[model samples]
Target chain A: MVVRGLAAPPTPWSKSLAEPTIDETAYVHSFANLIGDVRVGPNVLISPGTSIRADEGSPFYIGKDTHIQEGVVIHGLDRGRVIGDDNREYSVWIGKQVSITHMVLVHGPAYIGDRTFIGFRSTVFNARVGEGCIVMMHALIQDVEIPPGKYVPSGAVITTQQQADRLPDVKEVDRQFANHVVGANEAMRPESR
Target chain B: MFFPPLQPVSTVQSCVSGDVSIDPSASIASGVLLQADPECRIVISAGVCIGMGSILHAHGGDIVLEAGAILGAGVLAIGQVTIGANACVGSITTLFNADVQPSEAIASGSVLGDRSRQIVLDGRPGV
Candidate 1:
């Protein structure tokens, strides 16, 4: 499912929540918003100006005693854009007691483990996060894997944009048919070819 | 009458800072920012020292800084990465989508090791 933001940062104050789990002691912001098919654990705290949307591909799950800070965005995506069941598209999974701070964005087909803390303004797209991992603020993640109990310092950039490593040989496919129409009815007769 | 689940959108008060997720044992100086996404999870372990102007951002992914991790001022990190025990990240250091091994000291302007590098961190002991 492709959800387009009405504005650069859409603040849907009047939008009603479908079904969400929130603690009484937790504090969430006024400008922040959330969509349906999302699950939040207990003792979990949410801050203002944040938005979350769980794609039909996968369910968004947050663990107990976790905190979600301000200006953060979380969403699920499709693994295979054109061909796949709704459940097969995005396999994003978050472990128990994970911590995510402000201005952070996490895309689908990703997995995050338990007892980990993420810093501010970080970006993660299609990656795997192990348990007890610490991602510092302003770090960019592109198709990466964070080891268990490892730390990423602030402002680090990780991307597969430039690959110096040699890739396996795989030929690109070329289109074969420009326009070819063979009607079965025309050739069905004994004399037709 | 039946009660309903707390509406994330309907609530008037929203913002992570309003909730004190800071551990009592952890020492976070003034001007340090800790923010959490409403749809994700975040946690700061004990004995972590965040300098002034440092920001911790998390989302659906987990970000854990183990005990005794010292972050310099104005450091920025993103995504799901762990700062192991006793690791020191320099001031204004930027880490993108990677991890630093435990007890590693990474100097400024250095690249963080990836899967190809075999877990050897710069300025780390025995490196």
Candidate 2:
């Protein structure tokens, strides 16, 4: 990729992030943005107008067969979590088969589990989301723990553990919707021919 | 060439500075400003539609918009913002914090500056 030099340089922000990585099997749209130490997994669908920046945290990862849907933005955290005794640094980690909906933003040192569906215009900040969870539209998840298979209702804000624990279980149909997104995006890929 | 040319990749009188990464399938409309500061970057993902007159800037953090997302006209999302996949943000909306869930729809004329809070809108809201 060519980093075009401006006639008159605007600022020094251009080289903040290292080169991004996109797997061969992943479907990254022409207009999508992936900057700095970001790793997009196989069969993943990164839709139009989306952006993923890992400059601060470094090494943001998306698991296999996940869907990072439109207009989504992901930012890395200033401090990374240490995994076990290995001292491994982790910032933002999105699991496999996750569905991140439109206009959503994921900020800070967050961990989203596998097969989760984050709804439209929602915000997730510094939270830990469990697997197979359904975060409904306009929901806010901040510094909370969403147990596996929980379903957050629309406009629900989960600020504490009590609110997250009170949520219902994820429906089977909603999980299927997340699964179908993968195939649908492959069909929409440029090389689908 | 299968890979699109990078030279003149950005148009529409948009003032672009620093390091910005945009996917080929994404459409950056007119009157957009994409700027990156010393410690931040801008990455626009696939199938993204950045509406006209939108300003995406980064100061000390990065800006990333995931797949199938739409930033409506005159929108301003700055500093450590991550718009998730399939998200549809209405025109003139401003997002200051970070992280929107997948497929989330935000109405126009909205202001979401707090990362710990969520903005809820059903049908529409605007000036």
Candidate 3:
């Protein structure tokens, strides 16, 4: 059982015809904030203190039967979070049943394909997420296009140098942090979406 | 207004409004300053302890700690850097631009820079 947001914003108010339909069975946990016109599917769980919103003019979309666990946040800023509007068949369109976990932050414009499991506390900023990919917990995914059926291991920092450089770092400061610390992983098959 | 999960153990004063990820199980001593980008996200994992008078800033990027990761007082993981799972980082050391390998013991030191340079573990004689 999953809890969803307060209510889906009624369509006909925005210029974009496509609107999100949230399932009654999804779980949107405490302190989880949602904005913009995004679709949230069924059985999705959103944890505490997670904020999912779009900038004043854009929309964010989520698929059906997905589970976004506690503290998971997805948002779009200054631009709409885009999903499921592809031109080709088998060209990867967003579908039903995607799962995003606790404390994961997603920024747009971004596309997360169908039936994917984005692990806990993972950060996806400006990237294309493929289908059936298991993005492990605490992974930093930024500005990279993930192929379909790929498995991003836990704590894998998956961003380019350009994206990494965008974040500022103060010099000569005492810096010690866990997570994003490196480790080996066993080869595993991509989970089917 | 979300109060801390436990009793008011510490007080967060006025600062820029950014995301602060606090672990419920971990103890944060008083006078901790955490700054984050209102636009970006910040995540603090489980069973991690952040000591007193510490500040963690996440701007342009996110700050994350995995399960069971321990940080001595005043430790800072800054910018494009990641400390692996179950790794212990000593206090007062600043990590500017590097990723620490998991379970690789780091005793009170700073690891910085990318694939470009080697990290000279602080307090250890002879590079």
- In TM-score terms, which candidate is top? 2
RMSD of each: 19.9, 13.5, 14.7
Better of 1 and 2 by lDDT: 2
**Which candidate leads in lDDT?**
2
* Fnat values, candidates in order: 0.00, 0.00, 0.00
Task: Give each model's whole-structure lDDT.
Answer: 0.51, 0.67, 0.48
TM-score of chain A of 1: 0.63
lDDT of 2 by residue, A15-127 (tens): 76578788999888665667788888898888655667776766778889888855577876778552311235567878898888655678758878888888656788888
Q: Which lDDT value does model 2 have at B125?
A: 20
* DockQ values, each candidate: 0.02, 0.04, 0.04
Model 1 lDDT tens row, B34-67: 5443443445567777654455554334567777
Candidate 1 residues lying further than 4 Å off, grouped into runs, are: A1-18, A21-30, A55-57, A80-91, A160-193, B1-127
Quote each prediction's TM-score. 0.44, 0.57, 0.44
Give, for candidate 3 chain A, the lowest lDDT window spanning 10 residues. A181-190
> Tens-digit lDDT track for model 1 on A1-193?
1111222334354255356555554444445566665666665555545667763334566666566655466766645221122233334566666667545676666667776666555677777767676665456666766666665544555555231011111111100010000010121122222
Model 1 collision count: 63
Q: Which consecutive 10 residues in model 2 chain A have the weakest lDDT in total?
A: A1-10
